[model samples]
Target chain A: MKNKSIELMKRYRFFAIMIVVTLAILVVKPDMGVRVYSLAFNSVFEMLGVLPPIFILIGLLDVWVKKETMVKYMGKDSGIIGVLLGFFLGSAAAGPLYGAFPVAGVFLNKGSRLANVFIIVGAWASMKIPLLLFEVAAMGWQFTLIRLVMDIFGVLVIAYSMEKILNDDDERQIYELARKMSQ
Target chain B: MIMTIIFYGLAVIGLVFSFVKSREKTKMALMKALKAFENILPQFLGIVLLIGVILSILSPQQISQLIGENSGWVGVVIATVIGSITLIPGFLAFPLAAALLENGAGYMQIGAFVSSLMMVGIVTMPVEVLYFGKKATLLRNGMGLVFSILVAMVIGGIMS
Candidate 1:
């Protein structure tokens, strides 16, 4: 009985919180539940359909993507070229959020710099030239161009600042070693 | 509905297997389910709340007005920002985008919003921190937000 209670508490805590929040909304705003439930359920259904495929893809990637190749190109010793490669590869492989999760996790464990991991995920989740082109054909070229430029520039800043701000000694050591070798 | 069934079926299979199999295999299945639940639940609720706000405060007509094709670059920017904070899959978002387009919302704005909404999420901030370290999470989300805006605008501009 005690064990069961503890397990239930652990698992249901968040779900309880959700219920309380929903109830609070109901009390504050009559009929809120109707709209919220409608929206939430629909969104949930769609997300469910997408996540499994994304996870399967990531699982396959883990199995198929050669570890040695990742080391040779995206290894700790690699430089700016490594960063560029990371960016392009991430952008090219854009998929669901769940998909990127394990992929990023594997990369982190395998010596991919935290900074590059950050950038790759950002680029992958956000940038996809082919998809953007479809959106552009619908919206406008000028708007599309401006937005793309801003995004790339912003990602660069984000990657740089995250590296600097996190202030991890390990990353700094790698960055400095790479910098020294170029000179 | 189908996913729920699959989850239940898989869960039962997992349980029965665990019951018969070694502790190691059983533990692994439990861990996977726990991980999936951990990732899905909170952000899922967060999304529900945000959608509530949009529905209660902004009418479907209002959404069309604000994100209208003629709303200009500023409208696209606003949509992109909104999208970054909201988390939804492409399947739902794209369909909604199709509808919004019919309703007079610009493709670029929807595009930006969709990309950002899926890619970036303030809603999942806590989970992201737990999954990825604080700095990495912040940096990735920050970039996702910015890039999504660009994606929307570029898509919008080219199409328009």
Candidate 2:
């Protein structure tokens, strides 16, 4: 029990330090400290609201989707269909880029192609539909359109290159990490 | 708001269907998810606090000053670095970027900021490395940094 508690504290050391820093800021700079609390509260609220369903969906995907089925759609030899699906699913997502990582973990656990997974991450990062609408409204359609075209090209380049750069051992290690995370 | 509802609705519907098909499997899935989430909760808590502190330190006014009209390519580099380090939500980021743009920040700088803000994540590297490992996470962010620069240049050329 003592060892487990110590391990937990080690894992949470960063959070503890942040709390201490925040308290110091409260003493030294009250206004900035309040801002930190409010921002942190809002983020925590958002995370609580958003993460449960996402985790449930990931869990369901893991349980219901067979490895063979996943491989058929998103693994090696899945081809253009896999790429298109990755893009579509990512663009349709409704959460922050961080949220994509856990989902991506589940995908990797299920034997997704490396490039396809990277494409999903790229699309989630740069090309979500709601985010695009916001960009167009705030930055003008011309600016949004130009960035969109460029970002699509960048995503493709980055995804393919990331996949190609990984040797078999590196790829295996990543897969092992994903398996551990997803479990 | 609506997105949250949609996600919950989807989850509920999927859960119901899964339960109807097989109660045992549904239970197993829920257990798996809870375990996975528990494993990462500590890191997520740290990330939230880190972001809160960083954003408080680097207020919008401070950011605007660094990347305002005369800051040029130097501003783009600084903006990208700030964006990578910070972890603002999309809802907040767009408005923040808009505010900076209106406050005399250059198109190139704002472009770099927004692109890098979304594509690169130095703060969330621990979470990413959990699944992708250190090497892949670093490579992706390195590539993302390069791409964000390209994005800034293209936006600067066409928009400005």
- Residue B43 CA displacement from its true place in model 1, Å: 4.6
Q: Candidate 1: where are CA atoms >4 Å away?
A: A1-14, A23-31, A60-69, A92-99, A169-183, B1-60, B64-81, B88-120, B139-160
Candidate 1, residue A43: CA error in Å?
Answer: 2.1
* Per-model CA lDDT versus the true structure: 0.60, 0.90
In candidate 1, what are the lDDT values of residues A70-129, reduced to their tens digit?
666667666786689767966665334544554556565455676677667666665655
Model 2 misplaced stretches (Cα beyond 4 Å): A1-3
Alpha-carbon shift of residue B14 in model 1 (angstroms) = 21
Summarize candidate 2's per-residue lDDT along B41-134 as a digit string, tens digits: 8888888888888988998999999998789989999999998999888878888999999999999999999999989999989788888989
i-RMS for every candidate: 9.1, 1.2
Q: Which candidate is the best by DockQ?
A: 2
Tens digit of lDDT per residue, candidate 2, span A40-120? 888898887778998999899999999999999999999999999999988888787788888899999999999999999
